[model samples]
Target: MNRVVVLTDSRYLGQRMPGALIEALRARDMPAVSARADRLVAEVRAEEGTAPEPVWGMRRALPALRPGDLVVPRTRNAFALSLLAQAQLRGVRTVNRWEAVQAVRDKPYAVLLLARAGVPTPRTFLADRPGALAGLPGAVWPLLLKPPYGDNGHGIVRVDSPRELERLPWSEGMVLAQQYVDVAGVDVKLYGAGERVWAVRRPSPLLAPAEEWPEPVPLPVTRELRTLALACRDVFGLDLYGVDVLPSPDGPLVVDVNDFPNYTGIAEAPDVVADLVESRLTEVVHP
Candidate 1:
């Protein structure tokens, strides 16, 4: 029987969404299984007059998967992506294509594509070194500086002035600088699955108040926000993802895009994601 292979880390397997998704797929008789990406090994072979073959999960080998099997990428491991790339060549389908995951994994690359696609975003700049930041054109005060790649509010700094920018120990790496939008110390987290979206209001990492706001509060998904989120999906070819939007006077500005976000505040996300997976499976079976 064809199956749904959930590619994730062991840590996430015990988490809410990944754990729930496994059960949901199996409940639907989809023959779901979890493969901890970190524990899997892959072998790629190519020879004269033959297509490339990718064999995966040597450490804890997965059951042999056929072309019709579905791979749900729940982790961003590079090794996993390499394996997925080869698996795709062999006809395995991934929920969010590996290309989309790679694109959004690089913050600057994703932001550039979003802006070119005319998505509303904060003024942004990229630099190879901290010294170059002083010369960024159209830069505003209180810029949010971030490493080229990071997540969950890590490696982010608020530079309130030129002096502040110079005060920090300059690191040797690319940095993403953006116009920080202060929305009354709140951030709008837009989580999506297929065409559906849900919004939650959480404390802004860069502008949180002294008393932490209560756990992210669910918010109504507005028409404009919905359109914006979908546009991001289109830009990145993503089906399950998250968009971080800042409600500013200029309007909601997208600050970041995530691949298969935790769906932290969306209680219905697991079922919604399962529905999307089921639909994809249907397409594969019918086609």
Candidate 2:
């Protein structure tokens, strides 16, 4: 039997996902274990201030791999994955290869990449400093101000004027200030691996009743989004990951790509953990 080791946070690894995946791997007579990547600095440095936790260890070392080694990430912290990538250079194979994850981890960076790749997305401005705002020729006013590493819209706000921009909370670091195209406040999440995919429409929690997204309502997916998602996944080098795309009058505008996005939400009515675990185990077996 081959061994699989998982690295991640103590909570999510032990109770949310990694534990169940380990069980599934074991039932197949494969050795699976969980380990945390809390000590990996190179990976965190890759994503700047972010860090990732591992959730698994797999069978054998991949190209340039060592005698007994494997890598798996349970979080979406890009900087942490950078550290893991460095370690792997010495002979370890990590899941979600760093390529794709790094591309989409930073919200602003994702916006620019998607645009350059010809994928439709909201206009974005990368503010290296307050002075950069004046040169934002393409950015519109009343823009959306987001912390470079923001998630869940926590530090997001509307900036309509230069004075407001001056009063912005971010004194250091960067931000993604992009045009705010307010539609019906609808959102979507797409999960994919190989040729299999699941697309679900989620009403923006900002407008949802009590923040409850509608049951994963299936929607019309375009080859563009799928192509873009696949490109992103390939960039992540992981076959499994979640993408969040927002809809504009023009069509779909990608908002983000979470490398280790949580499928835990599915736990509401279904065993999301088990489903994801099963899928991951299958990938390990076949890969």
lDDT digits (tens) for residues 85-176 of candidate 2? 66455444555556666655667777766666666667777877554685555447767777777665556777776776666677547778
lDDT of 1 at 16: 74
How well is each residue in 99-165 modelled by candidate 1, as lDDT tens digits? 9999998898998899899998988888886667776554486788888877766778888777766
> What lDDT, from 0 to 1, does candidate 2 have?
0.58
Per-prediction TM-score to the true structure, in the order listed: 0.90, 0.71
lDDT of 1 at 95: 92
Give one clash count per candidate, in the order shown: 0, 28
The most accurate candidate by lDDT is 1
**Candidate 1: misplaced stretches above 4 Å?**
47-59, 136-139, 170-172, 207-214, 284-287
Model 2 weakest lDDT span, ten residues long:
42-51
Stretches of candidate 2 off by over 4 Å are: 11-16, 39-69, 76-83, 134-139, 205-224, 264-287
